[model samples]
Target: MRSLVLCLLTVVAFGSCLKLPSSFKKCDRKRTDFNQCLSDAIYGALKILDKPLPSHGLPSLYDIEFPDEVATIGNRTYGLLQTYYRPRCIGLSKPENINAKLEFGPLTSTLTIEATYSQLTVETGFEAQGTIVLLPVNVVTPFEYTLVNPTYTFTFELEEYEKGTTYFRVIDSKLDMQAHGLKLDYKQLFSNKILNDEFNSAMNVKWREIFALSKSIDEDVFAPLFGTIVNGFLKRVPVADLFDG
Candidate 1:
């Protein structure tokens, strides 16, 4: 009887050792596949601006859409669906929670991005050149003219990578007028008004230079502009190890 009791006790101990507690058997949350998560996060960050691209010459606030398949990173693919808008003289406010998805094999990751804007406002005040006097006795002359307000929208996208570093390219961009309502003389009380075309031309040239500078990948050319926009996005998202083979 003593020997049988000892054998039964040994069998019970062996069974207990083989059976792990429920908590010990649970999978660790931190051990998630980083490669996959990185891809999802990057795609999620861009989905914030996924709206229809406004047609050229349309003088209103409109959505700027992304392609159905914006990009492919490793074995994953990303796409953007929709965006929101608020028009202003300086810039348009992007919508909240722009929707997007990442697909890797059978896995799908969803994400949201809060879009915002940095504005560059160009304002020109000119004096009207040609004027006419309503009455010879009336010494005052009237000037008739209009004011032009133009706005440009800048968009961004990631392009290439090497090692742990990634490079971005201006994927799709636009230059359009945000507001074009005419500004006219309220009262025909003044005559010596003159319009300055030179100033307007100079302003346009400045804007072109700024846009060109934004596109240049050279550190000297684009660093300042990149810091303003792309850097923020990069900081918010997780980048995958570009060297992963």
Candidate 2:
């Protein structure tokens, strides 16, 4: 999920070209090495983007907060109904290796990125009620999850939109994410110790399947949100203003 927002940030960092931050290095759109230059600029921008930059129309990355959310995943026989409130995320590691590919079309353009992160952690207050393989579950706990070595690939289809100036807006987007490790912990489950242990063990053993089952749900919820955040800044500046001709 950090990857999704950071993907937006990668664009946001550059879109502030009207008054570029000193930390950011601009890339010539016509340069043969534009992609490499963008990758390097994004890496440099991440270090300073954690703090809010009102002049740049970018918010602080450190205190991003989400409103209440309710989502259900899987079939009735094996599904989870989860509700989260005031979820706050932190610990977004810098990307280890990042790549960006840009394609400019006659009417629209595309931006594709592959980013790898060493680690990320999220904490939330949530209530969960569902059935797992026939076992009923009811729990309310502060949830914490840490993901290791997560990688994400996302594509954004952008078109210039009139908002006083010719700014860019995402016409479409696609996101895919995978991780090498996940650690999840919750305080209690079903008011029973054995059930709690068994549930935790089961979740650890089948996280991959669980993640797959919930991937679509996640995309539906997050993709648009990320786009909105990206556009908040992108809409402030014109595409032509962002790059040297």
Candidate 3:
């Protein structure tokens, strides 16, 4: 670990003897200059993140349509539900409190990163028109909702191996849901207004559950996406290319 950290600081050939300019515009993947190139890229990315976000910021839109769905929460079961979600906006602020450590070895490389998000928002239209059997009364309704104030400590480990050609892989990932001041405004289309208000109030009371659900969803969705994106980018591109190019 110590050697890995040291390797990031100085290129082997230039150690204690060379000082490059603060800004290095180009990174050619040369074994002799690998470390410096990696350093320049990493710090440069951080510097870019530190800059103010554009007025539009980053927004992601997703449309989820389910013809039939089934969910068994504890003992209750919701079956044969037609659900749809059109996420109008899913946005996040630039990462804050970025902390990263890298380990480069003879055959493999690993990077662990930790960061926080100051704000995140999601505006969506959701409707699940279905029947939830509850022994005495069967509830059927179309639900719609929105959320905000998403904050969390995101951490992950990325590993790369050089058996034949270096490639990236997501070894592990976790989300620490520090604070999610989630405010949910939801309604059941067929249900009475008073009943919807009561249900929404009850839902708001389960903030912890919301955090837990978000974490689970993040793992299922984002984790695999990261693996795909990273590995795809590094698939044929050798780790050496980052430094040698």
TM-score of 3: 0.51
Residue-by-residue lDDT tens digits, candidate 2, 1-245: 99777647756764433546657677889999988987777666655767777776666655566675455443434587776566565643266777888898989999887777887666777676777667777778877666678876767889977644467888887777778877776757557778777767778788787667756765566566556666676776676656765
Rank the candidate models, highest TM-score first.
2, 3, 1
Query: What tens digits encode model 3's per-residue C-alpha lDDT throughout 62-92?
Result: 2222223222232224443433343332333
Q: Give candidate 1 regions above 4 Å deviation.
A: 1-122, 125-157, 176-245
Q: Which ten residues in a row have the lowest lDDT in candidate 1?
A: 69-78
- Evaluate residue 117 in candidate 2 and report its C-alpha lDDT on the 0 to 100 scale: 84
Query: Candidates' TM-scores?
Result: 0.23, 0.79, 0.51
Candidate 3 structure lDDT? 0.45
Error of 1 at 222 (Å): 16
Off by over 4 Å in 3: 1-89, 105-108, 122-167, 171-174, 187-198, 241-245
Q: Is candidate 2 or candidate 3 better by lDDT?
A: 2
Query: What local lDDT score does residue 227 receive in model 1, on the 0 to 100 scale?
Result: 31
The C-alpha lDDT values of all candidates are 0.29, 0.69, 0.45
Query: Candidate 3, which ten residues in sequence have the lowest lDDT sum?
Result: 55-64
